[model samples]
Target: MGERGVQVGGRAVLPGALRPWLGGIAGLGAVVLFGLGVLFAGDSRPGVVDLRVWAVVNGAAPPWLYVAQAMDFLGEPVGAPLLVGATVVGCLLLRRPRAAVLVVLGVGVTVGVAKVLKSLVGRTIHGDNLSFPSGHTAFFTSFALVVALLVAGWLRVGRTVGVPLVLASTLLAAAVMGWAQVVLGAHYPTDVVGGWCTAVAVVPVVAWGVDRVADGRR
Candidate 1:
């Protein structure tokens, strides 16, 4: 199975033999664990983890405060959705409908799951609404993940460069977005972590769906 995986245009695309069932199950398991952990920890008031992280994030310098505010805008209700829509349209125009659908579902699933879990846990901070998982973090991270996967598949920069450089840059962007949410006092560390975990949990499932659809057509 491992030997069957092939490189296309310098990018490694896993073989269809791996199957969607396995990836879907694995991804679902991770999502369950993340949801359970967040709900359990947030059942009561803010715990030590929340407080400590909150302190660190809130202790940022004035310049960092400005940066955080700027980064915050990137995921505002309008900006993130607009970017996602544009990406989806671009993929569709490129004749990759599967990729476009994956991008759309990727953001939708991540954000939807975050909202559901936040409501179920009923966690709030400083008398505000649910904030268990940072939606901003999830939005940007999921976008980055889907975009990276599609772009990497489309543009082959060799395994040596593509796998290391492209993947690293995508992750760095996600991390920076998460950090911005934390530094801006928009979310606790756990919230940011949960958001990231949500995106990680979602992207694979979406990819698996795309693969299954493609395989069925073939």
Candidate 2:
């Protein structure tokens, strides 16, 4: 079997190929939860959950605060391009053009969707800054998701292992970014959750689309 699994009708068919769709279903459910969060956070006031998380995640020591600041920078203009560009180059070096494309689309589209949702939801923090979905959280999570999918493909891992790996990687990345955003007071906890869900809901679908289009062309 190849890195992408067996090719059938020009499509890469992985072991337990149907299993990844389960993640898609779970992602949709998370999106629903995020929608509810938006409704509650639209007033720009932190809810009970947000406050609870804030109390725990906020107020770091100078050292940890610096770490969080560095994490924050990774999602900013200067850091984002450098990080993503390096990943894209790495994918290409590995001769995985599809993975390279995914790295771009997954992160770009996830962040774009978050921005759109911010305007639509009108959830704000620290004055008028829109914060419905934390774009920083979404960016890192989506990037992780893409990397996880690429790893699964390259290793030819089945759904049993692949799904958990992808979910875990995404969650880990989201948590780190979410913590940083909360610590920095850039977003409410609910905003971070929404951002995480946005990446979950978006990346898999984009992957599927990329596969379909690539397969069709083949």
The lDDT leader among the candidates is 2
Candidates in order, TM-scores: namely 0.74, 0.89
Alpha carbon deviation, residue 51, candidate 2 (Å): 1.1
Clash pairs, candidate 1, are none
Q: 7-85, model 2: which lDDT tens digit per residue?
A: 6333242223534564555568466746655585567799899888877776788998999999999999999999999
Measured by TM-score, how close is model 1 to the native structure?
0.74
Off by over 4 Å in 1: 1-44, 59-63, 156-170
Top-scoring candidate (TM-score): 2
lDDT of 1 by residue, 1-218 (tens): 23222332222232233334335534764776466565655554656777886776665687887888777887888777788889888987987776777888878888898788787766676675677777888788778767766666676444554445434644676678878877766676777767776776776666655555545423
Among all windows of 10 consecutive residues in model 2, the one with the lowest summed lDDT is 8-17
Quality of model 2 by C-alpha lDDT: 0.78
Model 1 poorest ten-residue lDDT run: 3-12
